[model samples]
Target: MTKLKTDRREVPVDEPLDAEVVSFRAAFDQRSPIDQIVREGARRMLQSAIDAEVDDFIARHAHRTDEQGRRLVVRNGHLPEREILTGAGRIPVTQGRVRDNDPDHSRRVTFAPTLRDAGRYRT
Candidate 1:
């Protein structure tokens, strides 16, 4: 029986080693624990910013109410989750949904994240 060095491990000569395993070892970049932490932090920060934007929008429309005093602008729910490719990696985000219940279509207000407003993503 004979042994050969594959990367840093010893493999028996009888067993075949994958060519990809040896070739891609230096090219492939494995995400470290720190990278995972950074990705999670970015995700949380983005989510917080989006939620704050929605809150501010609702506050601004607080004056607009119906005859029964119900607010015209309110949070309906979250939008479909989408993944954004960022420097940190792919981050899944769910933006808040704002529905303007105003009877006049001309005076309707649509809420969108500042990131989208920056022209980074299409609404």
Candidate 2:
């Protein structure tokens, strides 16, 4: 590789060169590896906990069926995708959905997971 020579009038030797000029972000962009690992761990843990909560909630009414042999609780699909901001970082998650089969068609229920103020899930 060849280095280009700069004109003396354009850039004085007393002043800093172009290569020496570093922006604040570029100079301080080094991230901590341990912090990244910890944040990833936290994200996975939160996701797992939410999944377990949904599973437990479904298990409560999954087995029983009505007189017509329709399961009491059935998995529909997923709710909506949303992200939650945490101390670690922003975590993305999609909660599971369930339909509660009732004898009366008008009284059927659908489970909607909500994030409580305590940083826990409420089904």
Candidate 3:
């Protein structure tokens, strides 16, 4: 026979509970079909808005061109996908990446979505 080691700790009333001991109420699998549908819709809408923002940025910089007469500020590709926590749930989104091909690094301009700057959506 082997001896068993059992350790116990005392908790204070003012102390907060550990994360492992707390249960989440908005678990993904536990959510209803309607909730899932709403989340999908929200994700699509958010993506569309971001795309529009990118388009607007490119339009505003249309005058900026290189020696070859090609637009300097244009969409290169998309950034890595990330999940943003929203009111509906965790929504996956990808932001458009803009490249400024200006030879002068000091005059280069970058694009940033307004939504990302807002504190409401925390990734």
How would you encode candidate 1's per-residue C-alpha lDDT over 10-121 as one tens digit per residue?
A: 6799887688887788555777888989999988987787889889999999999999999999999998887766788777778889999999999999886786543233
TM-score-sorted candidate list, best first: 1, 3, 2
Lowest-sum lDDT 10-residue window in model 2:
114-123
Misplaced by over 4 Å in model 3 are: 1-28, 119-123
Cα displacement (Å) at residue 92, model 2: 1.1
lDDT of 2 by residue, 9-123 (tens): 5666687656645565576565589877877887778778778777877787666688877778877787776666777656666767777867787767566555534454323
Residue pairs whose backbone atoms clash in candidate 2: none
What's the true lDDT of residue 83 in model 3? Answer: 74
**Candidate 2 global CA lDDT score:** 0.69
List candidate 2 segments past 4 Å from native.
1-22, 26-31, 68-70, 114-123
RMSD of each: 10.3, 11.8, 10.0
Cα deviation of 6, candidate 3, in Å: 19
Models sorted by lDDT, best on top: 3, 1, 2
Instruction: Using lDDT, give the best candidate's number.
Output: 3
